[model samples]
Target: MLESLSVPKRRVAAQFVLPGGSSRKVAVFLAEAVPGREGGERLSDLLNGSGPRFIPAHDAETDAMTFVHRENLALARVAAEHEPNVVDPFNLPTEHEVELRLVDGQALHGIIAYVLPEAHSRLTDYLNSAPPFFPLLEEGGQHVVLVNKHHVAYVETLRR
Candidate 1:
């Protein structure tokens, strides 16, 4: 049996850039409270392995490494969950613009923005037309969104 874990209260925000070059912001509160295990298995799978690995790129002129592509996957998950109306890839605003107020007495907030349809297409293409990257959690016999910290616009961990 899994030991009862304390759900950490967290706040998140994000910004997305739409194809039209416009941006939108998203904010929310996340806690262990979302409900049953949603994307936990998938997340675990992604993190379980030796974490992320780095491989040298073939390009001699430029040097790059390959990892789990956590950023892209995380963004894709959020987009899949919210289906933001707009996404802006360039000139993203700072986290201060977006804020998430936690009702569980956990203070948190920030901003998240992404580049629109183009980004979506690229991500979807990679995910093989899978549902956006958002994870689902059981809440009152219904599924709800469980935001991940990696992609959140901003996160503040309060002092206990």
Candidate 2:
């Protein structure tokens, strides 16, 4: 008799701010094996693999675990295979076209549409000319800051 292989569940929690100024929570589960890979690698495989087609966005971070607006459709489909309950309520646009003003007084515009949650406030405040923004780092046995999907300026990933 053959034993059945039981798959472990994977869960990702995130919060998003819609274009209408409303905030919502989202949870998704990627394949257990694929989720462990680096974000960029996973996305590359997903796109190049013979499974599905998802557009890659420039200006999007290549290593974040979160999905951006442009990738909403592809992510949704992938998530559905594992957990049908996971869905992207906000339809992601083909690209993110918003103009961002960085803390260094530089304006940046890109089609990237998602960011880490923990970096949201800092990014927002920086864009508003409130303070400087720095990437989170660990120093002296302590983390300098915590970055989540919200804190990111945009999202990127293919699948795997």
Candidate 3:
């Protein structure tokens, strides 16, 4: 009980640049009361494991290393629990000015709005999961536009 009282709050703020040419800001729980190098370490581990690995992790059955994004795994859970075509009914998404650079050398400029994650929410990973299409508001919020995840190459912030 004393530990609970002494524990301070913590969280992680992450931004995802989806393959479909769209990006979104996400917030997730840190699972740590006092944040440190843990998050950076986790990201580093992921990056290091991306390439081929000839050495055994201790056995011949071990395969080459793979880059795994935890967010992708979390997205699966969210997708299973909700309808993919329609977003869960929540508060209106926040609008942000963003520029998307596509793999085909095309670009899309608009305001993307998404439901802000709950404060100090640990569920940010689940929220980062890439959907088939991201529903964004464009044309000055006059149209509900769908940005396919597969088509996106990268996303950039027009303004901080």
After TM-score superposition, the amount by which residue 140's alpha carbon in candidate 1 deviates from its true location, in angstroms, is 38
Q: In the order shown, what is each candidate's alpha-carbon RMSD?
A: 19.7, 17.1, 14.6
TM-score of candidate 3 to 2 decimals: 0.37
- lDDT digits (tens) for residues 52-79 of candidate 3: 3221121113333323343332111111
**Lowest-sum lDDT 10-residue window in model 2:** 74-83
lDDT per residue as tens, model 1, 31-57: 423345433223222322353432112
TM-score, each model? Answer: 0.21, 0.25, 0.37
Clash counts for the predictions, in order: 28, 20, 5
Clashing pairs in 3: 20-149, 20-152, 21-152, 29-122, 93-114
Task: Report, for every candidate in turn, its global Cα lDDT versus the true structure.
Answer: 0.31, 0.31, 0.40
Which of 1 and 2 is the better model by TM-score? 2
Q: Best-fitting candidate, measured by TM-score?
A: 3
**Candidate 2 local distance difference test against the native:** 0.31
In model 2, where do residues sit more than 4 Å from their true spots? Answer: 1-7, 35-160
Candidate 1 weakest ten by summed lDDT: 54-63
| lDDT by residue (tens digit), candidate 2, 6-74 | 644344443333332343344433345655443322222332246433332222233434444422321
